[model samples]
Target: MSVDAERPAPLMHAWRHPAPKGAAGRCIGARTDLPVDRRKAKRLAHRIRAIARREGLPRAVATSPLARCRDVGRWLRRFGFRHVVDAQLAELDFGRWDGRCWEAIDAAEIAAWSADLVGHAPGGGESVRVLLSRVRAVHARAPAALLVTHGGWLSAAVWLALGEAHAPTAATWPKAPGYGRRVILWRLQAPALHRPSDR
Candidate 1:
């Protein structure tokens, strides 16, 4: 039952389900503002739940408490996830821009934010480094848990796990970095890809 005690510890699979990306300006809105992508949400939930079942997991955990994420976690719970931890999985908060559209962000603001996503919250959000440190601290102590945070957080996590000095605004490792794609899962082995359990 414990990661340390399993015949072969469960492997880490950082799946990326592109979360309704067309809402380019829509992705960072509040819970109530969540898009009505009922069809796509359900479809994504089904796919993720299927993976859990195949991987012999009853439920996958999460990294945030957003309504959209809670909805997905709830969906998985109904499908059969033993639990979905929501406290440690929130996406980086974009403070003042929390509920605005991408089109609304000032070009200079976006530029500044993009240029240095580590030191300041240009968009009034958590920096990549902040996300990385927080996520790493928590995930390091977790088992083979599932994380349903934002694309930024996921990409940063992958970057840190891969031993890169910094995470780029984009993930070049060809991974599932969004809301509807099947990103490759990777274990946090020394090399970041430990062998999966035989069972």
Candidate 2:
């Protein structure tokens, strides 16, 4: 085996940003950029700091540029952690469908996306394949990084970590981690295949 293959994967701890205001029942994506309550953001930041302190992880964090995720990173920065804002960590871009109520979108458009899960770009925005590629790049660049990101991004990371063989259909795609929830992506013994999955 190659040395790179023999090396263990780095650990990554990712937390979904706190739920944004006015996001309930809405198709909030990269373009939405909704705000999260400050208190909730601070609470999550404190939790991250406590975990880092307890586990001896680095005092550094990365977050999406969106307010919901960035707000948490800001709190971490105030607590003395090195904060990095990475656009790659942002949520899937939904294009025209962004920030609209679920019921407002056309059924046929939704079906079209579900039919091609991997290649179809909902709202004419980024495809699932593209999002997976971006997530993989982020992992490759900073395998052990701590992240504050969106649910869709977290789902992609989880899909990659699981070594799934096929692209996820609507039925197989794992649900998004709850807001403010932390998911630890352990380095797999073998490299994971990059495949498409939903946000």
Point to the candidate with the largest lDDT: 2
lDDT of 1 by residue, 115-144 (tens): 665766746656666766775775677667
Give the per-residue Cα lDDT of candidate 1 at 31: 31
Tens digit of per-residue lDDT, candidate 2, span 101-186: 99999999999999998899999999988988988888778867888999899887877777777788887766788888887776
Relative to the true structure, how large is the alpha-carbon lDDT of every model?
Answer: 0.56, 0.85
Task: Give the worst 10-residue stretch by lDDT in candidate 1.
Answer: 189-198
Root-mean-square deviation per candidate: 5.5, 5.2
lDDT of 1 at 48: 75
Candidate 2 structure, TM-score to reference:
0.90
